[model samples]
Target: MTSVSQRPAPTPRQLTRTSDRLSFIYLERCTVHREANAITAQDAEGTTHIPSATIGTLLLGPGTRVTHQAMSVLGETGAAVCWVGEHGVRYYASGRALSRSSALMEAQARQWANPRQRLAVARDMYRMRFPDEDPTSLTRQELLGREGRRVKDCYRAQAARTGVPWRGRRYSPGDFTAGDTVNQSITAAAQCMYGIAHAVVTSLACSPALGFVHSGHELSFVLDIADLYKTEIGIPLAFDIAAESDEDPGPRTRRALRDRINEISLLNRCVDDIKRLLIPEATARAAAETDRDVVTLQTDGGHHIASGINYDDHENATW
Candidate 1:
């Protein structure tokens, strides 16, 4: 008999056989159709039709709409659907197919329970996109440390530039007391971080519910990662944006803010580095696990799999 450890690792076929299933559909001003047993999509007023054989998840923006035929096709495909509302809120549809549900759930659970594993997976993902960075020496703790310092410094600089009082108080890992001006800054900073984290989670094809370091609650693990960036990135950016313009931020200000974020060299570099370090670690952790239980499969199959994996509803913190 083959020893469990000596057995050939699960091939894609085996992984899929035991995997929870899911797919995503992103609708950013695009229309979808089913033709010749394939899904075809086109942008509004655009001629190019993108075709997909299977869809595990569906993502939509506020203005996105689905025709009856499109819904029928998706249901037939047995894909889970996720959408972002006009307010940037997120929602998900239950998967109709067992295969899709198993795959998605497994991926999501792994995402939530282990930050190190998540970071490892993120690292691999970034490496695939940017091969120049060496991943062996990089770690999540290092990234978080660098980011934490940057956030503090950025906040201070922005406060000075904007003439906003920098409260001497250092923010701890908890909710801010009400009626404090410093609290306002903290809240703004947190919100910006949350947005970025949400973007990262969405891009990574992982469910935000499955978090690593953070306790599972209303705020996502992605949100927690985003929170980590608030002081370093969000606070300073918010201050700079508020200082540069005399008028309240409208559409133009929002666009400027986004552009500013994109142009941030240090922040972008850190994010890329962190992704490189995290993705592979997470993937490896998932690969090492032997458990086949769906719940364990979800929780134990990613990097940082051994620690900080709890789902407590009371862990919610407001900033």
Candidate 2:
């Protein structure tokens, strides 16, 4: 009988490297085609080329299609491509290479349901990122001051002009009634925030479900992040756009909302603050290993796990 010497587990540094290698390819307005078993893409610049095999997730907007050749190429590349249409609809196709990651994702799905754990994780994240700030302190008064009040007033006046319900207070997910104009506006805003948060999470190589503060439910972190904006940015902006015209918001409204959100410096700052807090803790958890086992655990954030991981290096790297 041959005895096996155990291999050393991967360090935290290795896990971070894996995460950095992950990339998200978002096709906001591009065309994909396949012909005779070759895949090609045409972008706004009129440039045509084949996508890199390294691309992990390929997201397409409405009306995007996969041709026979393109499908073959994608199949060979073993990437997961997602097509998103109007009203939050989605379709996806995955290749064989994604099987391993997909399995790891399933393992992750099992650990997301405890709210207390999520809050603890959120506190840890806050402590890690904002060591100087007190978690119990609500800075709404100091932060909002007079300027925040003005923005709120502006939002209310705009809402009134559109004949929409002016709640005269901050909006919450539970506030919207079903099938009303206000409800539609709320849903749209929430959806936009969801998309933005998803994009941000993908960009940061973090898992959206296994989140701090929001817990293990699907879309929890998204809900948390969206909550941060729905009242501050989304509500005001939605009202403003509606006030501009009595017409229903179509593509123009979508474009306007996107542009307005993009222009808000404060919104970007808030997201940056949240990201800085969340990523390190998740990374540290990812690098931990048990005993001598060199098990590779897949996290929602797409991090790999090894044994006895030290978070010091990962923390240092972020700084």
Candidate 3:
């Protein structure tokens, strides 16, 4: 076995890309420790090895204990670690991004900082969700109205297709068991989607609070990203799981959704979609600079200068 000190931290290129990683892995009643480049989960059964670099997010459910070395390896591999409730019902905390660059975050901020641009991105998101409909001329109220109607339609359509009974969405906060089978599954699926989105958002080094459609919350951007797949993936899958059986809908939906997400390569598409929404005009350039570590100092008139250089001088400089 290789000693811990002998293993060098993996570089950005050496680590698995977020788009190619597992959406999120939930572990409970296990002790997580590091062994070389992989994490070992020790439970009553035995020890299972998981490649740390391939994890987009690690959700530590109840009764999960993690060692410092495990965290170190996870951090080096740029995996987001989230402390979540059972079956990821409640989210408590998250780890850092995999990226060293802030270009995407800058692009997101630039689009969000302007009212017209923000509205345009919001409209674009609406368009992505409903490609057949045009939302370019709709006001925020109209967009919200349309979104509500469309989601309701999706619920009804999925119910009809699955032959499941639907009485609208009835979710009682803090009580997962309060809702019917479909509702419980929907909530579970949504939570899992949130986990996946949060991992992607953080991995891309984008601010989770800056959002085009949703606002005023730390995870507003996460919610916005997750909703992009609700009607298409989460809702339909939830209804399908509910149709199959009502037993343990939360865990069942999570497992099924994980499989579905991987099947559709949702992470890759999600990364591309977010880039298109926030920085459509600069996707190529953004992709090229995603892994760069260069930093620059801001100058007047939208200019950037080298960070290590001293700008103060007796001679007049235009900088």
Candidate 1 regions exceeding 4 Å error are: 1-157, 165-196, 250-253, 264-319
Tens-digit lDDT string for candidate 3 (204-261): 8999999999999999999999999999999999999999998999999989998999
Q: What overall lDDT goes with each candidate model?
A: 0.45, 0.47, 0.91
Give the runs in model 3 whose Cα sits over 4 Å from its true position.
1-8, 310-315
- The numbered model that scores best in lDDT is 3
116: Cα error in model 3, Å: 1.1
Q: Which ten-residue region of model 1 has the weakest summed lDDT?
A: 15-24
Which of candidates 1 and 2 is the stronger one according to TM-score?
2
User: Candidate 2 on 58-152: residue-level lDDT in tens?
Assistant: 55665565655565555454444556555332333222232212322332333334554444445544444335555443332432343355446
For residue 27, give model 3's deviation from the true position in Å: 0.7
Residue-by-residue lDDT tens digits, candidate 1, 161-261:
77866765444333333324443344544533454444344333346565544555644555555654554455565566555553442222334444555
Residue 154's lDDT in candidate 2? 57
* Clashes within 3 Å, all models in order: 51, 7, 0
TM-score of each: 0.40, 0.47, 0.95
